[model samples]
Target: MTVTVVVGNPKPASRTSTAATLVAKGLRPEAEPTVIDLVDFGAGLLGWGDPAVAAAARTVAESELVVFASPTFKATYTGLLKLFLEQFDGGTGLAGVLAVPVMLGAGPAHALAPDLLLKPVLVELGATTALPGLYLSDRTFADDGVIEGYSDRWRPVVRALTDAAKVADHA
Candidate 1:
């Protein structure tokens, strides 16, 4: 399966990226996900029709599964991520892709950010979000078993949905 992880953190190689990668791997150990760190895009995200940004959006659109992750900023996702997401055609750009929203916060106060904010945007972009969004503590995501726990519970479901999406694409 083609899996991709899109990190909206403004910092390059931030914990948000690492946690997102971990989540992608936990869901599919055999698949190597393409990681898109939005900070790398820099000014490219400001306007439309940047080749690299467009390419990134295409990569995400073609993926079977994608994990959209960001640090909790203002109790929501970053504007950088929103910029990247804006490259897509509304309601069709992400059709047939399965998306998992992930958010990292310093504490549990914004635990619902992933589902409440990120997931809806992905859905509006036409991605199927079958599983609940994942919220990880930025402080202890690596040391904690939250990623593993989420993977253990939802891996099979994700796989099944991916299979279905693939079939629909062919049909």
Candidate 2:
């Protein structure tokens, strides 16, 4: 499967990015996901038709599965992510893709941010979200079993959906 991990953490190589990569790896051990650290894109995300930003968005849209990760900021996803997502067309841009929204927070208060905030945007962009969004605590994200447990329960379903979507697309 073609898998991608898109991180919206303001800092390069932040815990949010690491957790998202771990989740993708856990979901498919043999697959090395295309990791897009939006911080690297920087100012490119601010305008329309920026080649680099457009290419990255295209890669995410073309992937069968994508893990969209962000550190909770002001109780929601970062504006940086918002800038990137704005490039896609609502309700169609992410068609045939399955998205997993991941959020890392300092505390449990914003644990639902993944599902409540990010997933809706992915859905609006036409990405199928078949599993519950994952919320990881930043403190223990590296050693915690959250990624594995989530993959164990949801990976099979996601794979099935991804395959089915591909078949449907070709038909």
Candidate 3:
């Protein structure tokens, strides 16, 4: 089973990335993971027709589960993620794929941003979204730039993702 994550955090060392890393690490051994950082691709995002972008999109298309991650920008997912997702032009969307939306922000007020904003987009992409999109407070989860320090509330969320992955495997 393949599970991939498309991360939109701009910094090389970012909390958003860390959160995704944590999720990837938790996947079942049989569930191989592909974690792609959009910033690492650079410049020709619109040149998505390039071999690399095409390859990455294929990874996304083939994965049984996808963690679509981003550092909340203006209360929504980053443009970097938007660019990467634009590469899925085959009109397949994310059909037959399960998605876990993740968003990190400076304040707790934006906790609902993932569910309210990102989830809809993931659905439009044709992916079945796991409930309660993960949201981490930059202040609480990113101390000294370390995202490994998950908040007390993050446990159940992790379990939810794990459960979803199992369900997707069966489906």
Candidate 4:
């Protein structure tokens, strides 16, 4: 399976990026994961006519599974992330791809934003969304689901995504 991960965090070395990388690190070898830092696309994304944007969309089109990661900002993901996603035109944006959403926030209050926002967009693009969006707080993001005394208790999410990714039946 060709797995592609889109890092939507605008900040350099953001916690959300780190967490998404960690998940990619654990991908099964057969998947051949590819990580694309959306920042690399730059200002060209503002206009759909850029060739670079089309290239990025092509990469997304070829992947069997995709992981969309972004830090929860102002209750949703960053505008840059949305801009990058918008460049995906027609069937190339999604079709035949399964999307896993990973989001990080300073607090648990914005935990549901991943599903509320990312999933719908992915669906609109023609991708099948994986169940149980993963949400991690900045603190204890590597620990037992507890960030500095707060427990998000979101383990099933990771398990479900990993299990779903195994559905790579590319022929």
**Best by lDDT, which number?**
1
Q: lDDT-based ranking, best first? A: 1, 2, 3, 4
TM-score of each: 0.98, 0.97, 0.78, 0.78
Q: Tens-digit lDDT track for model 1 on 42-131?
A: 999999889999899999999999999999999999999999999988899999889999999999999999999999999999999999
Question: CA shift at 29, candidate 1, in angstroms?
Answer: 1.0
lDDT of 4 by residue, 34-119 (tens): 77777877788788678877887788877766778998888998887899888765554687676777788888899898888888
Runs with alpha carbons beyond 4 Å of true place in candidate 4: 27-32, 90-92, 145-171
Residue-pair clashes per prediction, in order, are: 0, 0, 1, 0
Query: 46-79, model 3: which lDDT tens digit per residue?
Result: 6746777778888888877778889989878988
Instruction: Report, for every candidate in turn, its global Cα lDDT versus the true structure.
Output: 0.95, 0.91, 0.73, 0.71
Write model 2 residue lDDT over 71-146, tens digit each, in one string.
Answer: 9999999999999999999999999888999999989999889999999999999999988999999999877777
In the predicted model 3, the residue pairs found to clash are: 94-125
Q: Lowest summed-lDDT stretch of 10 residues in model 3?
A: 144-153
- 150 in model 1: Cα distance from truth in Å? 0.1
Best by TM-score: 1
